[model samples]
Target: MNLYQKLVEIRKDVINFSKDTESFGYKYVSGSQAIAKIREKMDDLGVLLVPEVKNTISSTYDYINAKGKECTDHIVSGEMSYKWINSDNPEETLIVPWQLYGAQDDISKAFGSGLTYSERYFILKFFQAPTDVDDPDSRDTSNRGKGNKKGLSEAQVKRGYALGFKAGYDKANVDKQILSKFNKKIQDLTKEEYEIVCNGYEKRGGK
Candidate 1:
């Protein structure tokens, strides 16, 4: 089969979430898990997937921690391209673009984190891995009855968890930071407060 045909076959394969890869109280399909499964399929089909970093930009941001102490962190943002090459016909290939971001207190780790985050997300997204989690928009009255509608939305909570993990913070550290700043758990944070938390993570707690 050709590269596209092989990819379509791969897409038809079922990739279940790794129940052991838990973060923020939910199981996710980890990068290694996806790679392992996909790699097997690729080898069977004589297909190759390669990633190339196109460009990256780095900068520093200043922000206040949950302890109200000012801190600076290195942030990296970049684009990468992935190539799907046909093993038999080396000239046949398809390229896809991916945008990624990462932040850390250590300059040495910023770009590495960004690359790893990008690759994980790319694999999951491209493969359409089953996360076994319902979409936030699927809820109608379930959240309304709990009065959680007045607090952070399900989408915001997921985003917060994702950003926190990407920035190399564990669930305990994330909740501790939130509690220190707002005296509330993630589920209790208002939309505005959640925005502050997201800003801290995405923008390195700046401004």
Candidate 2:
């Protein structure tokens, strides 16, 4: 590898690294190895960065490059996968372009000011947000554990109304923000009234 080989992308989302849409899928990339090592002491808490023998920028490019590749395996999310760049020619120099995205919302709502973009948070998010590692295929068909999507979906709205109706004030409080968007009578809506509401949702193109 040359002195210019950047092992990790500065941003958070790896899939966005391509010219158009990247075909390769790589995970467990520590944004910076120094960050990964510092987070390692969390004891099974799964951190992204840490310090190894004090990674200093003042060091030579060769030293930095060597350190990056050497500590590649020590990354907390130990495994990463990507298919051969050219399926037809598996002999090619393993072409896996490392790209990172900062955060989804930052990219979307970012103003022209570069300072605002830099201030945004760094988070690792998957398209479908894969968590399982047991399967060989890249597709995450099974979901054993996961957090709710950052944005609300139709399913989420429906569930919120359902719980509110069933448990009244208790369920309404389950997620106060969501409940607030619901119709005031949502808690009191009966089976028939609920069906009516759902029918309206369907007609309004709820999905």
Instruction: Quote each prediction's TM-score.
Output: 0.63, 0.15
Best by lDDT: 1
lDDT of 2 at 110: 18
Report the C-alpha lDDT of model 1 over 1-207, residue by residue, as the tens digit: 888899888877636545457644446666677777788888888889889986555655555553679877776655578888989898999998876566778866877877787787777778776663632222322244344345554334545665665556766788899999999988678666876887788665221
- Residue 67 CA displacement from its true place in model 1, Å: 3.2
How far residue 30's Cα lies from its native spot in candidate 1, in Å, is 1.2
Model 1 regions more than 4 Å off = 132-207
| Best-fitting candidate, scored by TM-score | 1
Error (Å) of candidate 1 at residue 153 is: 13
CA-lDDT, candidates in order: 0.68, 0.27
lDDT tens readout by residue for model 2, 1-207:
211121222222333322221122523323343234323332232222211121101100011121255211110001122222222332432322221111112322212121122111122222222322421223331221224322222222333333333233233353453345454434333344444554553333221
Give RMSD (Å) of candidate 2 vs. truth: 21.0
